[model samples]
Target: MKTFIIRSFIGIFFGGFLAVLITNLTIIFGGLEIIDGPLFVKNSIGSILCGWFFTVSPLYFEKRNLKLSQQTILHFLTVTSLYLILALTIGWIPFTIINILLTLVISIFVYTIFWVAFYLYFKNQARKLNDCLKRL
Candidate 1:
């Protein structure tokens, strides 16, 4: 519980940071004006919650006895659904079919990149551990 709380805090901070960073970047590159204070705050809070869930949702994999593929599918679906709902509600993405489809495609791409990176990293770690055990 303590660890989870700590992780959640980290996620919140990360989310907030990303929200600000992305907003600033968009304003800079896209020539968009800064939004109103209340709207900005709401969007920031939404991003923070999104980040919190994205961080903690993986804890489900720890407790479940499902296969790796099954766990991945479930996690992806759950996280993606949460993201879409939160994004639409917070006005991060407009509630249009085209916008939703585009957001979904981008989300899948980002998730795939992360999944591949983590998979390779863990596989390498496992190999190194196996080698150490063989020497013992």
Candidate 2:
């Protein structure tokens, strides 16, 4: 359980960092404005929370024999709802639509990358453990 929490935190942190990095990169390339600091903070937090939800939801759904489509829909709804609530609580800005959309896209991309990285890491670890056990 502790390992799971640590892994989840790492996933969320990296996912949030990736989104911020991409956003800043785009800004540096003159693609978008830097926007307000508080808004960006909200976005980063939302991305991290969404990343956690996205990482775990599918596993829970799968354990319950849920369809992929159902899982996808639930994931979308869950992330969207959380984003909206956080944004609202943080105060609405005129660029709410753009903020929400950009955050959602970046969060999804970062979360996907984190998921793949974690999956590969665990797979390799499991293989090493199996090999060690066989040798023992």
Candidate 3:
């Protein structure tokens, strides 16, 4: 349980950092100017929340014997839906479409890397715990 909390925090911190980095890079190189508005804050918070939620989702579901593929799909759908609703609430339909597309592109890469790291860390811990239990 302690390991799970530590790994989740690490994943959220790194994942949030990566998402910010990517957003800045897009503004720097892609010629996209950062919009300063309530929507921006909404999007930023939504991304971080999504990162934390997805990071922990797989671990929680795995204990119930859910397959990785199923967990991944479930996380994707759940996060995407949450993001869409948040975006729509902030900026209506057109802005929500834009937000969803951009968020999807950035989040797919960021979360995939974070998820893999978290999974490997927890898997190793689970193995170690199983070994310790067997020894007792």
Candidate 4:
């Protein structure tokens, strides 16, 4: 739990940094003016909240004895749904049908890659451990 909180803080810090950078670019290119300073503050808070939400949501559904695939799917769905809802609510993304489909596909692809990488890594470690035990 301590590690989770620490990592969440780190993620929020980085997310806030990225939010500022992106906001500046949009302001320049999109000619979007921030009429109030509170907009910037709100963006920062939103980024942090979104990051923390994604980081922590899967933990609530995690089961120790579950299959890796199940865990990965659960995490992926939780993060993707939260991200989509938040993006739509904050007007970060338009809620067009094509845009929604494209965004969901991209998110699933990215999350599957992340989870599969970890799955393969842990599977290899377990295999090695089992082989070692057989030699004992």
Candidate 5:
């Protein structure tokens, strides 16, 4: 799909930009040196893929004629699990219970907020369309 590809490219671009920014910020704030290593390349690829995944996964539920609550639950379950897996694999989060739990909580909260915002935005658009149609 053209829309999917275009969105994926945009997502990866911004995600990579943020990844570089955050890496530099950590080097500055955390007093860490930038390492030009294979891991860096790996992380760069992982970050791009993660961004693409997040952009597309939620739309799986969005394309269906599901209730808002259903979409929220499905998106949370799918996105959070994938996010945790991707993050842990990329060494973004340590493989420990505390880190895992925190990642899970934070991922859920963030995606929930995202879903709610989009849901409300589309609902408002629908309302405006309906109002227009009534005058036809």
Candidate 6:
């Protein structure tokens, strides 16, 4: 319980931080400037919630009964849905077909990048562990 609380707080902090960072980046690069206070606050809160969900959703992977593929798919869907909804609500993305598709494509690309990076990292870790076991 204590661990969970700590993890949740960490997740929220990262979420809020990332939200602000991204917003600033968008303002700098995306241009069309001028974000009012209310909009910023709303977007920040939405992003924090999204981040919290992203963090805790991985707990689903701990279900050893589910195959890795199943867990990955479930996590992807859960996180993507929350992100898309928040993106739309916060007006970070407009409600047009092309915009929606583009957002999804970008999201999928980013997710794939992280997924592959983690996969390679863990695969390397497992190989190192196996090598150590063999030596022992």
Candidate that would win on lDDT: 1
* Model 6 residue pairs with clashes: none
Higher lDDT: candidate 1 or 4? 1
lDDT (0-100) at residue 121 of candidate 2? Answer: 95
Worst 10 residues of 3 by lDDT: 87-96
Cα lDDT of all candidates, in order? 0.89, 0.69, 0.71, 0.79, 0.80, 0.86
What does candidate 3's lDDT look like per residue over 1-136, in tens digits?
8767876796678667866886787789999866566755665666666567656655646566777778778877787677567656655335655656887887798878878898899999999999999999
Worst 10 residues of 2 by lDDT: 54-63
lDDT of 2 by residue, 1-136 (tens): 6655765887698769876896688688976755767767777776677677656544544546776557656765676567567656656434577877877787688757865786699799999999999999
The estimated TM-scores of all candidates read 0.82, 0.45, 0.48, 0.70, 0.74, 0.82
TM-score computed on alpha carbons, candidate 6: 0.82
Model 1 agreement with the true structure over 1-136: per-residue lDDT tens digits: 9768988998999999998998898789998876678977898899899889988888766755788788888889989999899989888889999999999999899989998998999999999999999999
Predicted candidate 6 versus true structure: per-residue lDDT over 11-129, tens digit per residue? 89998999889889988998946987887788789878877887888876788999989998998999888888888888878999999999889889998999899899999999999
Cα lDDT of model 4 overall?
Answer: 0.79
If ranked by lDDT, best first, what sequence of candidates would result? 1, 6, 5, 4, 3, 2
Candidate 5 at 94: error in angstroms? Answer: 1.5
Steric clash count of candidate 1: 0
Quote the lDDT for 97 in model 2.
75
Instruction: Provide the global lDDT of candidate 1 against the true structure.
Output: 0.89
Alpha carbon deviation, residue 116, candidate 5 (Å): 2.3
Tens-place lDDT per residue, model 4, 57-118, is: 66744578877667777777778888888888777779899889999989878877877787
